[model samples]
Target: MVKIVALVGTNSENSTNRQLLQYMKAHFANQAELELLEINHLPLFDKPADKKVPEVVRQMALTIESADGVVISTPEYDHAIPAALLNALNWLSYGIYPFVDKPVMIIGASYGTLGSSRAQAHLRQVLDAPELKARIMPSSEFLLSHSLQAFDENNELIDQDMVAQLEGLFEDFLVFMQITSQLGHAHSVNQKLAESVSWENR
Candidate 1:
């Protein structure tokens, strides 16, 4: 089964981004095994080099590393991705390098008129950093504006048009994951070969 993990931003008690992710997870239930990465337990970005890494942080990194792909559902805060989300990423960037070359899909929700477009743009920049080097999807972005009304009482995205669009996005995302999986396999083999050579010369 194709396993994907959703990383939800905002530590808010009633985070709409979390709700949106829950809806998507259920929406894609038949196609993929979509799981949620609970980031609430993650502490601030204290670099793991010096401080003892929290158990939650270690589990978070392992979840991302093990997943076939990642879905980042974030909210905008001052026209940027929520600090909590960025902080979690910062921690992940330094430790196990889980985000390195990982295939990611970005989605967001906001109560404002513009949605979380700006935040997603900023997030793309962050993911492009050398430490993370995330391979984000190249399709039209998914942004849920006025998020409260965008969904039904049951949290289903009500817009049929948007639903159709997501269907397309999901299809593309699946193909992207497949290609990235091949790349990851090749990279892993290359790494083993390099390690063997180093060991032989020692």
Candidate 2:
């Protein structure tokens, strides 16, 4: 089975983003082994001079590196990704290059109708930075709007149409991962480049 890390992009106690990822985990259990990673406990990124990443962040990076791919479900806060998720990404990219050449799928849930469109676009830009260099899936989006009512009492997506859309995107993600794996000729170069980036020096 393909190992995938589903990043819960918020630290909120009652986040619809978390619910969306949970639903994906259970819904796609047969197709992939999805592990949910939370950023709630990671301390705010401070860019220590020594560049030593926190133990928790290091472990999280290892998990992400070992996975076949990552799925990030974000929530929009002020038309942008939550600070918690950005903090987590900052730590993950400080000195480690886990995201370099890694396949990523972006999804989002929001209270408004825009469905975190701006946040997802911001996330894509962030992931494309030299330090991260994630191979995000293109031309594919899964946005759950009015997320509070998107699920049922059982925590499953209530709308059949939404479920269908999610299923299609997930299947595409699996294929995207396979294609990305084959495009790894520059993986070593990319990793080295990403690791060489030092924000403090710049």
Candidate 3:
């Protein structure tokens, strides 16, 4: 089965974004293995971006690196991603660059009518930055606006339209994973071959 890491981009224990992520996990359980990585557990990186990663952060980075794909359930704060979530990402970038070429799917929930669309956009830009190079699923973004009303008392998402969109996005993400992994492997092989040929000539 495909291994996927799911992150709820907030430090709040009562986060609706985390709830939405857990709810989505049920949909992909049969098709893929989803491991929820908590950002709150990470030590707040007060050091500069150039500083070394803490041991805990390094382990989390490894767990994420082992995954085939990633899903981020984000929340908007002041029209941007929450500070804690962004901090976790910054630490990840300092190490082995786990997100480099990794397939990612971003979704968000917000109190506003626009959902966390603005935060999602900012996240995509960060992921696509030259240093990180995460490949986001380009097909669709699943945004839940007025999020509290979007779910029912059972802590389940009740919006049929968003559910349908999520299903489609999941399908596309799986395909994206397979294609990107193949491309990554092929490039590695070519690079190795070129090095071997050069060594033989020397």
Candidate 4:
């Protein structure tokens, strides 16, 4: 089964982004092995304490490393990605660069008109690091300007079309991850073969 880690970037208990991500998780409940990683547990990054990392940070790194792919749901704050998300990324990048070359899909939600578009753009920039493999979804549309009001108290997605779009994005992301993983495995096999042949000839 495909292992997917759903990263929720909001700290609020009633975060719309979190709710949306949970909805996506439900869609893949039986089809894929899903794990949720919330950013609330992560402490602020500290360069000085590099040798003794917090347990939460250590766990976060392990999760990112083990997952076949990642799905991030975030909210825009001050026209950019939230500080919490940035902190989590900092932790992930410190040791092993867990996100490097890892398949990632990002989605954003907000109550403003922009629907976290600016934040998403900022996130894309951060993930543009040479080693990171960020997957850009073809259907890029904002779900906002009344997002909170549209959803019910239970956090269930009320709009049918919105639900359909999210489902399609997840489906496409799963396919993209599978193909890329196979390609990576193939590349690794070829490199090993080349090394073995060189050693044998020597």
Alpha-carbon runs more than 4 Å astray in model 2: none
Prediction 2 global C-alpha lDDT: 0.94
Q: For candidate 3, give the lDDT.
A: 0.82
Error of 2 at 118 (Å): 0.6
> Best by TM-score, which number?
2
What tens-digit string does per-residue lDDT give for candidate 3 at 1-202?
9999998899998887888888877777899998889999887666544456788888887998899999999999998999999989877865346777778999999878998988999999888765467779885788889987887887777888888888888898999999888768554443344234321222
Task: Give one digit per residue, the lDDT tens place, for model 4 in 167-198.
Answer: 77778888878776766654444334423432
TM-score of each: 0.88, 0.98, 0.87, 0.82
Q: Per model, state how many residue pairs clash.
A: 0, 0, 0, 0
Between candidates 1 and 4, the one scoring higher on lDDT is 1
The candidate that achieves the highest lDDT relative to the unseen native structure: 2
> Per-residue lDDT of 83-173 in model 1, one digit per residue for the tens?
8888888777653467777899998999988779999999999988766777899855888888888888888999888788878898899
Off by over 4 Å in 3: 48-51, 185-202
Q: List the residue pairs that clash in candidate 4.
A: none
Q: Which window of 10 residues has the lowest lDDT sum in candidate 3?
A: 193-202
Q: Show the colliding residue pairs in model 1.
A: none
lDDT of each candidate versus the true structure = 0.82, 0.94, 0.82, 0.73
For model 4, give the 10-residue run with minimal summed lDDT: 193-202
Model 1 segments beyond 4 Å from truth?
48-51, 185-202
